[model samples]
Target: MSEALVAAETPGTGIEPVPGVSGARQFWRRLRAQRAALVAAAVVALLILVALGAPLLTAIEGQDPTTYHPSLIDSARGGVPIGSFGGIGGHHWLGVEPQTGRDLFARLVYGARVSLGVAFAATVIQLLVGVVMGIASALGSGWVDQLLSRITDIFVAMPLMIMALALLAIVPSSFPRPVLVTLVIGFIAWGNIAKIVRAQTLTLKGLDYVSAARLSGWGTWRIARRELLPGLAAPIITYAAILMPVNISIEAALSFLGVGVKPPTPSWGQMLTAADVWYQAAPQYLLLPAGSLFVTVLALTVLGDGVRTALDPRAASRLSIGTGRKREAKAAKGETEAGKSASAVGKAATEAGNGTTEAGKEGSA
Candidate 1:
């Protein structure tokens, strides 16, 4: 017989080994089981698509972000859109801006490109700096480690928003606003990640495998690349996912404050800045960008949480809980059926004995 068959036929030794799944597969399985998280992932994906294909989408709608249609605005009422819902109609799917009469739909998708792009770019910078600093601090000697630690503490203690505002205000207007915002945010906001990386690196460096690699005379870079990076990836990814939404909000806030992306480039925050005064006259002008920001932030937050849960081996998955509940229900139903069967059997047996007693009495009589 084949070894497989023989093993199957044997007792403990014959049991077939269950194939182990890859980490990515396990993470995806857990993530897919969460309906809200899955929906959020879909929404995030759609937003990305919208951001990437902004030009195409706008072209399809036959609208442009910069072009102003003054005719659509009611001059009598402080430049409110002529029609209801912010002048939403066949020509403008979302509606027009209050005074400019610029297509909101076109600007929205383009704004997504700026907002998400900056967030992603800034996150990349933060991650790179954080991971390097963290690894260096953990792997370095006593003095090296102390220096980096002190620096990290200083950064942690600093007020980030004030620093960002000062830096942004000092920068020359000749510099590109989007790039300036990205650089400022990326450089200033890496302290938390650095701290997290440092803690994780310290813990990981003491593990057996890391020590083994060190004993084997692996260079620092080699050890980091081969031994440490694999261990660091999960936490790094989890943190980055959570950090992106914050970056988006920060970028939006800066723009709303007039320091972010300039006019004509289009940004959600910039749109809000313009729409603030017209909230009552044209609520759609305010609502469109606000709703988009809300949805984007909400989706990102949910997706990030889902990722964290999926990546954490110790965390109980919702899917497992659901399945366990189903199993328990099935067991309870089976027990109930068994109980009914036992009662029916007892009733029949009692009836038989009673009949026998009556028949005996009749015969004796």
Candidate 2:
């Protein structure tokens, strides 16, 4: 009745069309099917919400993270104060700092803003550059592909950490720290994403939909955008999921090294660095930020793994092999029916000619 239904019903090609669900729907469904990914997603979502709602949370706590509480510090306790590492039930929920009695909870909440923002920004840039370069490399031929491929290879060959350090050295520390860090990390780390995209594009560009678009006089960029891009979504997202934790780690490392986001601007890495010396006095100082980083990275990594496994068609093939076979069998049945109809037509024609001859002979007799 409908064009979509007609198309869905029609079977012309050897490759069977997967019915019912659209690609986006299928991708989401697959993602939902992954239990580990779902849990990781929830954790990541909670982290993001916490990061986004930092100001509100701080306001609710009535604690200014940057404000020093010299009164809260007890000099007799060997720099460990009353509020520092004091159990959860007080005005300072996560306790206060050792020297400067800043609220740890407020600082942690605010620090998440910097960490998530930088990581997400860098990841966005990485995806944009990497996906474009990769698709362009796949679309081009001859010298174009060669040049792009060589450029990607060169980037991959370089020691990215060293390159980032060198680049950061030139940037003024007082410059927009998060933006600079994001650019440096994004520009330096897109090689792996490009490689993954390039390989995926190379495979996808050869598909029937892409070929059909090409034959219908679509420009390279148009075909790439409309035809190849959707197919590349899963891998691109999967790569991105993998890249996020790496980006976060890089930001943390730079902050820990003191070249990253300067003082007064809180970061988990900076907190950890500050807390290192206080480990002997208050273990919570070292544990808080370190534990946060660990959990964030671990959650992201698990999410990535879950996404990879969920989207892997090869892995899922066993479950759907029977359905695939049924499609093949249906196609085969259609062919068999076509052959039977052709044979029936030929037989009927033969019988009609025989009847006509017999009538002519009987009439003549």
**TM-score, one value per model:** 0.82, 0.78
Candidate 1 lDDT, tens digit per residue, 1-365? 01111111222111232346555665666567667789989999999999999999999999999999999999898898988888899999999998889999999999999999999999999999889998999889999999998998888888877888888888898899989999998988888899998898898789898899999999988988888888888888889989989999999999999888899989999899999998888888888899999999999988888777666634443334566568667877998999999999999999999999999999999
The pairs that clash in candidate 2 are none
Model 2 scores a TM of 0.78
lDDT of 2 by residue, 1-365 (tens): 11111122223323233566565554556567655678989999999999999999889888877998877777787557674254344577888888787888998988889998999999999999999999999889878999999999998888867877787888877788878888988888888889998998898778787788899999999988877777777777778888899888999998898778776788998898788888877888789889999999988987887666555533432223456578768989999999999999999999999999999999999
Model 2 regions more than 4 Å off: 1-19, 75-78, 84-89, 316-365
Output the number of the lDDT-best candidate: 1
By summed lDDT, the worst window of 10 consecutive residues in model 1 runs over 1-10
**Candidate lDDT (C-alpha), each:** 0.84, 0.80
361 in model 1: Cα distance from truth in Å? Answer: 34
Error of 2 at 175 (Å): 0.3
Worst 10 residues of 2 by lDDT: 1-10
